[model samples]
Target: IYLPYTGTTIGSFGYVPMEQMEGGKAYAASDLYSLGTTCFHLLTNVHPWDLWKKQGYRWVNSWRKHLKQPVSEQLWWIMDRLLPESYQHRYQSVDQVLEVLEFQSATPANPSQSTSKYHESFLNFLTSLRQNDQLKKQVMMGGVSLLSLGLITQGYGYFRYQTFPSNLSFLIAGLPSSTYLKTTLNGHTNSVRSIAVSPDSQYLVSGSNDHTVKIWDLPKGELVRTLNGHDGNVYSVAITPDGETIASGGDDNTIKIWNLKTGELKNNLTGHQGFISSVAISSDGKTLVSGSYDHTIKVWDLPTGKLKQTLTGETNWVSSVVISPDGKTLVSGNGGNTIRIWDLDTGNLKKTLTGHRDSVVSLIISPDGKTLFSSSLDRNIKIWDLTIGELKNTLTGHIYYVHSLAISPDGKTLVSGSANNTIKVWNVETGELKNTLTGHTNWVSSLAISPDGKTLVSGSRDDSIKLWKLP
Candidate 1:
């Protein structure tokens, strides 16, 4: 009888008596049904019966049915519990529903508890706004009232501290010194084909020939989760800026997105004519870029799995692709011994970078986009003045083909993995050999640097991924 317009029925927490109440027991199924009704109302901004009138609710009749975008699995699961049909099949107790909502467990607050305090104060402020004119007046007057001055001042201080600066001033300074740190992750069963560090450097993602991507928590050195879907060797993996989703490309000719935390496969994006050799995610994580042996680079709408555009022309395989830190530029290397830069927004070819005598295997761009580094089968890594598309310097020392390359976060150290089974670190400023890391028993296929510029990771054909500490 107490159904308010706010989408919740306070009196019918879970049910109503068949006689006295409008409904029966407030079981899990009944709760689920109510939830579905409530959700439909929230989504369409109309009443549940209104959707039924137009048959729009038919699309949401089952839990398995796919709905429109923006609904997360967690939310979907909650809706199912809230709108079940059968009272017996529905959650019998609030505890059951609470379990699904992850409210079954409780823990003490943190030592500081400032976040808790802030949240409590926020709720009080919101409630007071309705009845306490003193608070409302304070808000209307730019939060300047004697009655609320202290709370307002504290809230303002908290808000100011919580507002992160536009950029970390330290990151703008360029790559930190190469001081190698070691990491240990255990999960992959076969040769690791690729490794990509998260932008924040907190998570490390690796794709393996074993047909899985292993996500690892860094610094602490623990396996977080394994992403499984690809049928063939996983060649590349890229984590979006938000760190909630992971995009992986592989020999399966498909790219799959995974929920990083839940380790669930979101969707399979398929269209490549051949094995996808490389993948990169835009800064916003809304678009995905991939290259394949099919001799094409494709951009995709990450949310809808739609192909945005395809760049074609390579007579040979496209090996590696890197989206510049700014997300506006894309650089791709191909078996044709050339690299091309594209304006991602317009899908227009910006410049063709050429000079390598052999197939270009890998490419990386400095944070500032001022320098481009590429490794090629010609046993050399070349630096380019990206502003003018001119070769700045050719770094040579590897006795065998260079297969993978990575630049330090500061752009001062460049490291390359080679078929010679060695990882070479170089001085970007002087083009001098800094260190030769030897440990791999087979061809080194992929390399990555930690965000702190303190660790280097290399994947080899011997079915092992090793970590090298930089000095």
Candidate 2:
């Protein structure tokens, strides 16, 4: 038995068992449970607390699906035995587990060896048969005879199918090539300034310079509805994490929230004194942040549409704003070529990073919240270390201003839309250009990657949205 004292500090409470949570005595099985939880966390990159909150130990199924490599059934059984909620059901002694492992290890070599031998003998027989001329000729004649019969049968079936309707199977194989233009969505009458895909990837939303926000069915590229509330050119749009609400900001100096499902106006938040340039929603969908030409950032309560806090210190127009995945930090790009990191809870400026030679037009943080990518009017994108506030690397290839940027869900690929009428894809790890996509007749205004990372969507100033199939 083990007793956890009052002052004992655990590195991660997620690894602790339920008995420890109740501040009661624990047995050796509790320690085994903690060990198993640690193993799961290390293997699947998921926390035990999150798993418990979501579905208790049933999260093992989810973790197993996410494994990078397969594990033996014996190993899975052992892990499951260790994670039982009841101590009485878990392995009572370490010696018992070791004995089971030892027995498994000692019992498994001969079957695979015998299977390998059988396969080798079968292959040798086929080779020998191929080398024998007489046998080969006989086999070829037999195969030809069978094929002729099959062709005759297939012809009969084809004629029969012509008279009676039936379904047929067509073997179409091969994935999409490296990068190809999939389709062009045409509805926005003016320049499409911003684009966002819903969390489920079923709907796409676009804000255009024609003073309209349009929603389209993602799979068919058909216009679903047109929202006509913004009185001026709509510049920025964001979908809530839940995919139920959309927040859009534009030249009207107001942020409008719309019901994503019904396309009805939910609320109109007004506070900015100038044109709103960018808008972003927290990962939890509880807070909405907007940046405007008034040189201020406003954080609002998403549920009630009430102003929560206002942050003002930038000297020029605030062009872009993005929240970290953890929902604790906010990064903003301003027209003065500076990036500011702010404490989301306190609304205080934490650090100011400077490197761009011209206006910072776009900002995006990595999915891990460790690195930040920013695009500038200087025709370059800079990678920054968010923790230490240092410039890590600079990517240069665009001949004109870089207007928009997006990162893949896996954080391996970074895509940028530029004023040069091209989209560039880069390897995030090595800062190498992977591919340059060209189709837009004018500047590329916005870019977004679908949740599956297999589709890249670009909205260009040519008044069109193009979808690209990614490798």
Candidate 3:
């Protein structure tokens, strides 16, 4: 689709912003103007070239004059942003444009349908305009119904019908992926720092900055018990494979064990001088690992609460730690931009994998124990071949720090929780991002997958836990 430019100009006529016509530069906003013009032409039968010949840049200001029929305020606002004469006034990126589209086309017909709901009250604006039957027919005849009022009606059945109007589907498909949001569990007084799902998939334990560990009935989303013993914020939580005991580590530099069924404080282990950042229980539920701001990875006996060994050499904070499913390896991520592989029992550091330029925020091993995924403050998720101890691939999509990583039990899908307040579902084999699920208003701090791999649980700085169906 190359356009024949007369001299210093490119891009198709009226769709081009004034800055580009003057041989300045083209930006994302310039492309947005083109999209807006296309949507306008589709809705009103008014060609952009004819308008460019008549009013030039001033045409956008009086765009409504050519409209024979009216459009909903939500649709009007979306078109208004896309058709701004100045690039500075247009939507800066495609995400911003689609964000508006999703918000405007939102449906509250069911909880699952509105899980992707951003701001519903946005449609309350621009309703004073008269309704247009012709415009609705024009959109219906054309598959691209950006101005479809049926989307705004009581039915709002895109999900109900299990289909979407063609061109609008393309836009929605690329934006935040539609997901079935199960429920939001809120109880923490502060940031919910970490979360873990029981092996039986019946319970979920969450650690929070509120200095408490709360257990919830997973199926019902009901708060079961809140264990309060940590003097400071509970930074990490890990449940045993048997689902009998839970270990919680916190800012108070203590790891407390509790009965998952009875909510009894079993033992409190203390050794590290700094705040605990992460805790992991092995698949066998025999060994427990803790990484801390104290710059060391401590291995402890899960049943007896005795300090086994402290693997040291890190000059910075140990941000996260995890045990392999086979129960033979220990991986620790630190603020020093390196991942440490250690012999779980010997406390010997085997290899220090380096690729991330910033702090490694989280680490997770594949179920098969063949691959390791590490997230970092560099905004990259690196996949490593544990056997070779080398980088396999780097997944780059998150705009902010990749805070946490979780993998389904089958090891085919990987999900990353980001500081951008969104969770990205990725295909492990191809490294392709399958979906970008957004709802949380703050940083997504931690993620856990149910044993059956059907549900995903996320803990966020918004002080809420969101359960989402695997897309």
lDDT (C-alpha, whole model) for all candidates? 0.67, 0.76, 0.76
TM-score for each predicted model, relative to the true structure: 0.61, 0.63, 0.64
Candidate 2 local lDDT, 369-397, one digit each (tens): 99999998667999999988999999987
**What ranking of all candidate models by lDDT puts the best one first?**
3, 2, 1
User: How displaced is residue 99 in candidate 3, in Å?
Assistant: 25
| Global lDDT of model 3 | 0.76
Model 2 C-alpha RMSD to native: 26.8
Worst 10 residues of 1 by lDDT: 164-173
| lDDT of model 3 at position 21 | 78
Q: Report the C-alpha lDDT of model 1 over 38-80, residue by residue, as the tens digit.
A: 4444444555544344643232333233333344333433454
Give the top-scoring candidate (TM-score). Answer: 3
| Cα displacement (Å) at residue 379, model 3 | 0.4
Per-residue lDDT for 333-392 in model 3, tens only? 887788999888787889999999777889999989999999986779999999889999
Give the Å error, residue 87, model 1.
64
| Poorly placed runs, candidate 3 (over 4 Å) | 1-178
